[model samples]
Target: MTTPADRGRRGKDARKRVPRSSHAVWVPPVDRPDAVAVLERQGRDRLTELLPIRYGRMSASPFAFLRGAAAVMAADLASQPHTGLTVQLCGDAHLLNFGLYASPERALLFDLNDFDETFPGPFEWDVKRLAASVVVAARENGHSPAKARRAAQETVAAYRATMRRLARLGELAVWYQRIDAERLLPLVRSDADRRRAEATLTRARRRTSLQALGRLTEVVDGRRRIIHDPPLVEPAGASDAAALRKIFSDYRSTLSEERRLLLDRYRFVDAARKVVGVGSVGLRCFLVLLTGRDADDPLFLQIKEARTSVLEEHLPHGPYVHPGHRVVAGQRLLQAAGDIFLGWMSGPQGRAYYWRQLRDMKGSADVAGMNPGALWSYARLCGTALARAHARSGDRIAIAAYLGSADTFERAVTEYALAYADQTTTDHATLTAAIAAGVVPASPDV
Candidate 1:
């Protein structure tokens, strides 16, 4: 095995490909499409009827537009210089994507919770996505320009610090490290921050399957099934259920023996097409309800459509032919712990899909309401989690050495983020203009 010192030396060599200071520069590609075209291209694979809703959600705010424009950013980032460092990127590693979720051991852990666009890509791509999100989120919260810069700086600083620390530890030790509520509380800057974090965790703990059961389903005609709410949750055709069961049986084969045996106890109840987040509104996503032992015991699985990652256009192709397998594999590689029932399957029409618990104590920080101080603290937590995730897949020693002891990389990222934030605003305005001209259909009332 290579020593940390050797890895450090190897990392220093990366400066030749992309000098450390070169990272500070931001040059928009001349061939980049107008924002409308990017949005149109992304909607091509989506459900035609739901594309308008997706546009509406994205048009709500600049931050919302940034959230849904991961592919657009991916194309831009691909044009930038990189040091050739790669990791299993969350691909869409925005601030909201970092959250608290229950592990199989029932521990509420803080980590990257989204992986729809996960793939191997330049490490800086994830960092850039996160840093720009800080600025966009801060601006949305009515923070001052200085505060936005500080938030971006704080996030990258935390990432640097965490990576430096992890570089000293053995690989196994670093892999075993996890951040839970107890570990996260001390990082808070004040009593109010602690209370907020605790409150969020408390709220998440209450969001079990029972809570979802009460909210999303009701008894109809002596049967408990998902409720139909137009443009959000709706029933599938009666014939769809049997086909899904057949498809799900194939999903079961992908699970471990113990998990498969455990899952055998639950009987399928019903499934529904559900509209989810801003970026995923049009994709094929389903909420599958299952009953175990009795009506009181319920399990909800989210089956999400998986396609070729946005990063795939820029990065090399992975070995997996099934996109669902790529998502499952990337999630396991980046997350410290994952759902017990995490698996992948082929859809009825042969599209790829991956399944996991829909809402197992899941909670995200309310970025819109955060003050500068609170946002700074939250940024640090996200940076730490992101560093840990990258360290798990990339050479921590090398990346840390490249970052060095100073604030060079952090400052550069802050500058890049500010520049990118301006670009994002311009792009968002283009989208707004297109919508006004009826070029891109959007319905806020929906």
Candidate 2:
């Protein structure tokens, strides 16, 4: 495990090497009988028990199947020999998770979004996931494997090259900043792409507190209310409402004294159980809207269900994980700008995750709908953003050293992406069959 001080130190101190003779640790093969058994056992269809499963499923559409595909691929890739440079990885590093967002200073920056499977594991784990997603998403968008593979190689190449570049620059440059969108655009290939990037930037510009107010709070009967569509109730139930308030009350303790003081400016205004994300369909996720003083002064917060990371059960662990801190700690380590209101607390009702700002000009690049030219642009962005995130938590030099200059790493990831994509098709088939047999009832909508 890396200490805060150890992580802060320059160079090799930040990263630890994982032995890679193909025999250092036992990584399971997903195609093996045991691995298949584990997936089925872990898989479920109940809304709560299956929320993660659904999250994975919904995340696997024409535009985005890669995010939901990580667990399946992780099970497959874990069976392979890796360089074992374990650092905190976003776990799911698809292009969609890389998006344009406004930094606190109001600068439009791009960064990693999802981190549920984040853990200190082989950095390549993040790479393979990104590459495979590039392929899967590209194929969905009608790109040839030749194009997709090249795009995948581009992603692997960018991660390796950037890490090496940052490694040479030393720790300060890696930690003190990120590759902003302006610096990022020149890497994209097409005129359509440059235009699309500009449009996303335009959207990001439009994401602010004032815009956030429209999506979260609305005037109903002349009183402001957070929108709700039953089952995902707004305001919660009477007694449950009070308990929800209590949860937020305790959540304040997780923040620093300084942040807590900043939060004093805002008071809870409205809260409700919001059905969010395809995967989180059944778990309890609450949306809390806050007001600074008057009704027009608004802010939004989300309290989601935090479950055990899939990485916890499979990979060789690094840090001691207190269940209460899983989401918060993992997120801070994995994302560049996590929710300022991000905090964690556990209750007898089970674990609930609290975060702020549900929407802020937040939108994903549509990979499935993208032209082949745009897929390359999108893949590179996700790859670079993910690498930037890893460089923050671990030593870049050692990692860049392990990756080397050859196409060896890119070849390895491309090979793995193909293998895992096959495994996902097989698993998806099994899931499809399970639904057909009525073992897992198919939602007519799905």
Candidate 3:
């Protein structure tokens, strides 16, 4: 087995090839429209009827636009000088994507909650994506450019600090470390921030499967069934339901024997094609409702389609042939504790999907409404969370050495974030133009 010391030595050797100071440069490209076009093409395979809703959400603001343009940004990040230090990336890492979720022990843990675009890639790619998000979100919240830069800098700085701290620890220690809800309280800067965090946690605790059933389903002749919400949450056709059952069975085989036994108690009742998130709106996402013991005891599972990661187009080919398997593997590799039902399946026509609980104490940051102080504090927390994740999969010692004690990497990343934020605004305008010219279809009703 490769020991932690061996990994640290390897990390030190890597710094000799790519110095940490080299991270501080950004070269703006002239051919940005091509990247924008790539994003438009990515949406081609999605559900056509929901394309309007996807575009409508993306067109709301530059931050929202950036969230939907992961493919575009992935292409851009690949062009930069990468260190060749690979980690399982949260390819679409952004301010709002990190959240609170229940771990196996029923504790609320704060970490990266979205992994739709995960793939093995350079560690810096995740950092740059996150820093750019801070800038974009700050702009969307009407904060000054100086505050935005500060927020970005704080994020990078926190990552640097956390990585440095982790580099000195044993590999097992790093792997075992986690940021739970109680630990997250110290990161809050003010009393108002504390109250907001508490409120969010309180709300998340109540967002259970039974709660979702109460809100989303109704009793028809004493039988509860999902309500239809056109273009958002609607019943799957008979043919699709058959395919889904097959996929669900295949997914069950991927789980452990214990989990399978636990799952066997629940009987699948109904499923709906649900529209979710800015980028994933047009994709095939199903909310499956299952009941155990009685109608009062419900379990909600989400089966989301997984395509080849956005990063895969730019990076080398991954080991897994099935994208669903790739997503599950990446999530397991990075998360300290993942969902018990985490599994993958191959569906009809070679479509791939991963399954997990729909909601169990899940909560996310509201970046668009955050003040400067709150944004700064949130950036630090996200940075710390990200560093721990990277340390588990990448060379923390080498990354820390490359970053150093000085503010060199932080300044460079902040500069890159500013430039990228500008590019995001320009790209958002391109999308808006496409919609206005009827080159792209969009709906406001969503």
Q: What TM-score, to 2 decimals, does candidate 1 have?
A: 0.98
Worst 10 residues of 1 by lDDT: 181-190
lDDT of candidate 2 vs native?
Answer: 0.65
RMSD of each: 1.2, 4.6, 1.7
Q: Show where candidate 3 strays beyond 4 Å.
A: 1-17, 30-33
Backbone clash numbers for all candidates listed: 0, 4, 0
Model 2 stretches astray by more than 4 angstroms: 1-66, 230-235, 318-320, 348-352, 444-446
Candidate with the greatest lDDT versus the true structure: 1
Clashing pairs in 1: none
Ranking by TM-score: 1, 3, 2
Tens digit of lDDT per residue, candidate 2, span 1-446?
A: 76433433422332233322222222334446443344445444224444434534543443333444455566655666555566787766666667766555656667886665667787877877777778777777777878877888888878878777776775566677565657546755677777776776777777766787786567888777777755445566667568777777678899888878878898877778776654345656777778887777777777776665666656776474554476578777766666676777764366556465666556556565688777776677777777788888876666776666666667767766655655555556665555566555334333
Winning candidate number (TM-score): 1
lDDT of 3 at 403: 78
Please give the distance, in angstroms, between residue 27's alpha carbon in candidate 3 and its true position after superposition: 2.5
TM-score of 3: 0.96
Model 1 scores a C-alpha lDDT of 0.89
